[model samples]
Target: MDTSDVAETLDHLVADATDHHYSPYTRFDWVDELDEQQWWMTPDLLSVAGTRHARELDEKQLMRLSKWEAVNFFSLNIHGIRELLIEVTRRIHTPGFELPSEFFHRFLGEENGHMWFFAQFCLRYGDKIYPDKSLPVTTTEEDTDVAHFLVFARILVFEELVDHFNLRMGRDATLHPLIREVNQVHHDDEWRHIIMGRKLVGLLYEPLRERGDQDLRDRLDLYLRRYITASVQSLYNPSVYRDAGIAEPFAFREELLKDPARTAYHETFFKRITGFLSSQEIISGSPFEGSRV
Candidate 1:
């Protein structure tokens, strides 16, 4: 993981960011209400999609679930953006991060706009934004290199997970125009972040690998795998199910989460990040194996 390998890519990303800048505030036309009959999210991307639980729902229930799930999706974005912002801000001008600091400025600004829009969508349409339930990842004080790698690796993992939804919903014609536009805007910006984050995470992980600190590496691997699982589990929010008028929301959540169809869907969607991590030797093998509930 030579640092020089990413300098040119970072410079190009900065140029692209500068050239394609937009004010997220005025980018879309908001309405007093979104059509209830319209799909807020693509049906295939729903948490319970491909499960027997989804089949039990009528059209109205499915649409209702879509609305709440879309809100949950945006809420996840708001929280994820906040965490990434804090992590990137901590490293922007710090030691060992000189090369990508320029792009960090653009990344922060774009992500702030992203947070605002996501919050706005959730509050205006759903009448509330769900609270973040993600557990914090704490680092030991002795291993600054490990801490640094985890910061960017978590960012990469997060962006990769969210981008799957963004890219799909962005192009999905079945969804409302507002939903599509919002997703497209996020998808456009996140592509750059994902690329930059992947390179930066790899660069940050090199020092730990070179030091041959097997214990630290093992710790990082286990934490990241758990983080990945937790990230996916957040999608099956019981609150979303209850808000959608589903009975026995908690049980529904548990059932859907452990559904084999949902598990396969998770693996399919998670392939990119998992493959990248394995290829980089950041983890030993497929993190999802025996990791899900």
Candidate 2:
């Protein structure tokens, strides 16, 4: 309810933090044991799954696509975790944090471990992490508090998007053992991170409300929706399609993105967050308008 209630929840989280910690080192076998022909993502979850274009691909192509799709997915995680580490770690010993800092320390440790394992996968197999193509723009604002609120809110938006992937991929049996284990470990850690994010974002939003800042509201709404679209779109890498030998990868990406089935799948990707953001009056219901492209 209140920020204090949020802190209380975090206190409980901090108390239980040690119990949830996993050593990325000991838990997974890092050998080159993956079958290149095996899938790294679920076939049903593939970008082109429900499209008529599905008929064009043979079994070998599907496996090849899933292989790189996995690389793309894990590379995105590596990028995301690094971004979060920058945000969370910088906030840890700062003035405002009184109760959550201890938990944040624990959080930072877990995230660092996640970065290591995720990068290991990308580097070991793909030999390169996907460089982030979009540069983030930071706007200077007079209201530092409002800015702080937006930063944390943006973090929540990003976390929840990845949370959907982790929730599914962790349990998807068709994926390779290493990928599944990575997904599950990250999922376990992210449960606490998402809890912290929802609480923190709600607490920060009240200040903007008190200031009667519709401009800021509109700005955040736009950012959140755009970020969601970008996150979902990353899952459908053009390189994955091209490498799979799909013709005209860019044109195919455009077609698949607009496909009704893919559009609906995009909706499902943001389903949990869409309702919550709408209920919070933080954004319009389904701001991506079920077209999360």
Candidate 3:
């Protein structure tokens, strides 16, 4: 968290970003349509996976659900990228952000490209992108450093969660080739983002930690834990279920969210991010530990 150390990391990240940049428009060969018969997402990554609910669906119905889940996943990326872009934009070139602003330019461009491709996939294949339904994180912290720390912490958590899906789906051969390609591309970009976010979040929190603001830390931890929970919950959209032709969409969603198997999946999925937050002393433990919905 030294000033020189932060500057050096940003320098290397900025260089990497510059050397690896690509045009999103020409990056992939778009087919007229994605095959409806193939899995758009890995079966194990689906919302209903690991539960009795998955047993009720026939293969064709499960494939249909996968398609909607894939769409929902891309839509979530679009919305998440937009939120992080806004937060980063507010900080770039501003006071206290001088060190990371150069990399922020690269971050902004890459994220915008990401939003474009994710939207393209959702629109061309699914006919519509799902709307963002999760509420924004609201905080009572009046300290500038606290506010800044929260912004980067939220960004880090978001990227880590998205990368969980990206890393798995990108390598999953059961998914369609285009699905794999998109995920692979995203996974590649997200590594840089995640690394940068972690470094920045740690640096941002250092000042607060030095002040021994245990009360403030506790409050921030609660806010971020709820944010993580809300983020995961957004995937269980009733609209997604309805679009998949599932009966009693709301009731089905409610049941699935409370399922023990689903809770286990959530814990496994969230392990890395929660561990990282705990390492930073940002949170005492995993939010999904013994958590329901």
Model 1 alpha-carbon drift over 4 Å, by segment: none
Could you give candidate 1's per-residue lDDT for residues 1-293 as a string of tens digits?
A: 55566999999999999999999999989989997677899898999899886788888889999999999999999998998899889888888888989999999999999999999999899999999876666666466877788888888988998899899999998888889999999999999999998988888788788988898788888888888888888888999999999999999998887777777788877789999999999987766687554
Q: Which candidate has the highest lDDT of all?
A: 3
Question: What order do candidates take by TM-score, descending?
Answer: 3, 1, 2
What TM-score does prediction 2 earn?
0.92
**Model 3's TM-score against the true structure:** 0.97
State every prediction's TM-score relative to the real structure: 0.97, 0.92, 0.97
- Model 2 Cα lDDT, one tens digit per residue, 91-185: 87787766678888888888888889888888888777877654464556567776777677767777777778888988988777778888888
Error of 3 at 72 (Å): 0.5
Clashing pairs in 3: none
For model 2, give the 10-residue run with minimal summed lDDT. Answer: 133-142
